[model samples]
Target: MSSTQLFRVSGISLLLGALISLIAVLLSFFVNPSFTAPPATFQSPLWSTHYSLFFTALALTLIGLPALYVRQRGQRGDRLGFFGLLFIALGTFLALGMAGYFISVLPMVAAKAPQILKATLTETSFSIFPLGGTLFATIGTILLGIVVLRAKVFPSLVGILLLAWAVLNLLGFALQSGLLAMLVALLSTLASAVAYGWVGMILVQQAGVSGEAAYQPQTALR
Candidate 1:
């Protein structure tokens, strides 16, 4: 397929991913359990649904990353975008692993071995995966923001919003479970989805632009 066609498909993937991710975020309060909630919470249909949606978002986001990188790389010949893609891939893979673990494993744990969820697992891999995902994702996003800003292929605001979201996420990791942490998570997730959504909308719009337009800095933004 043509480059513009690729962008259009990638754009749709990212746009849908962002919208669904936002829905999952909104559902979190009602569906996800508090840190102190009982292990049986895992069995809730909503919990599975929430993470399932999140998993889909991650997958789509990863699929769209190459197109995002392509725009930057083709314009500037920069290796930074590749590194950004690498980190994002690592983080997404780790997150997907955890989500799959929850969707497939937790229900059984809740049904058969409730204590495992309450005690050992939480203190171990469960803790590690989120921490690692957060770190890698934050770094990846920051690098991406930098490349977008430097490349000047997409909107300057795209980079700004991405940086903002990454910083908020890093701060949330430092916060204890509380109102502040929840707010940070909500805002950061929103910023990320909006950033991707904005890029996707622009990509879809530009799908008919001449391929030469891709070589022009800020053409997509214009």
Candidate 2:
């Protein structure tokens, strides 16, 4: 009901999201083997569980993101943090849709429209929005890293981890063709989970001390 309570809830949500997302990332390797392949990988029994966990992660992240920025930006405002939150929120929402499709629609497609599913996996260029969402989220995270350093809301290590995650992902995506790239991509996910977890812990600590600190402008949309 109060600002402190809201922040505490947000912190818990972020921590839980980070944990779930990390688990999903780990399970994905058993399913996809490669970061960019989805052709035959979807047949794995873990596919649904992986995406289900991913969906839950994104949902929790979305819920906590507002408080993340609110707790850091203070009354003066930081445009960078606001935009970062906006980008991440939009991207996560899009990714959630893709996860839902994977969990629900893809199965039906495989059963009834095998050809469609095959094409969707092999040459289906239309389903690129999930990639787009990832891009936005990555960029947003990088921006947030910078904002963190500037705001001094958390330890410098937290920002460094966030930056590392984005940079590694960028490296992986740009390389796009080697075993090294895949490893870098996987590292990026680990860095992301650690960064978020660290930040969430700090947020929880801040919440307890924030006291009567009610932040206005709940979201960038306002």
Candidate 3:
């Protein structure tokens, strides 16, 4: 109903999404013992967990992050924040498209005709977008983190965490073929969860306080 209420709802949604995504990532590890498994891996029960949870994560992020941005930017006319939100929205949409296709279409196709799994899987790699949705999201996160630091809306630590997460991811991607990259990638993944969780907690705290006082935009930092 109110701006504060919206932020609180967004925060809760983000937390739930982060939790689900973390579980999915964890379950994926136990499923095939490989970071990038073949289509056959999708036949396992964990497939349901992986696909459904990732899709849900992107969906929630699509809604939650934008709302969080709104609460932070408000009517101050922050251009950096606005662009950050736009990039996030675009990336999330692309990710949702990719995830939805994999979850809904790929499995069915793989089930009905196993022969085409190889071709289909290659055609539908998660990083289907030109620049890649993950990259877009990562860049957007970095931008948002910078905006947070400049605005001081949330704890600067949250911004630092986000920047660290993005840098880690970028490094991981660059050295993805190496053994050390795996470790770096793992750290990056965990950082992502933690970053979102921290932001969610901040939002929840702000919402909790909103009930006591009229929702003032500047009051969020307090």
Q: What would the TM-scores of all predictions be?
A: 0.87, 0.82, 0.81
The C-alpha RMSD in Å for every predicted model, in order, reads 5.3, 6.5, 5.0
In angstroms, give how far residue 179 of model 2 lies from its true place.
5.5
Clashing pairs in 3: none
What TM value does model 2 have? Answer: 0.82
Per-residue lDDT for 107-214 in model 1, tens only? 888889876767756666577677788889889999999988989989989999999999998898788356777678789889999899988888877785746576
Tell me the whole-model lDDT of each prediction, alpha carbons only. Answer: 0.81, 0.76, 0.71
User: Residue 117 in candidate 2 has what lDDT?
Assistant: 72
Number of colliding residue pairs in each model: 0, 0, 0
lDDT of 2 by residue, 112-216 (tens): 676677677557753565677778888898888888888886777778988898788778767764567657866887887787777778778888767524333
Candidate with better lDDT, 1 vs 2: 1
In candidate 2 the C-alpha lDDT for residue 220 amounts to 36
Ten-residue segment with the worst summed lDDT in candidate 2? Answer: 212-221
Winner by TM-score: 1
Ranking by TM-score: 1, 2, 3
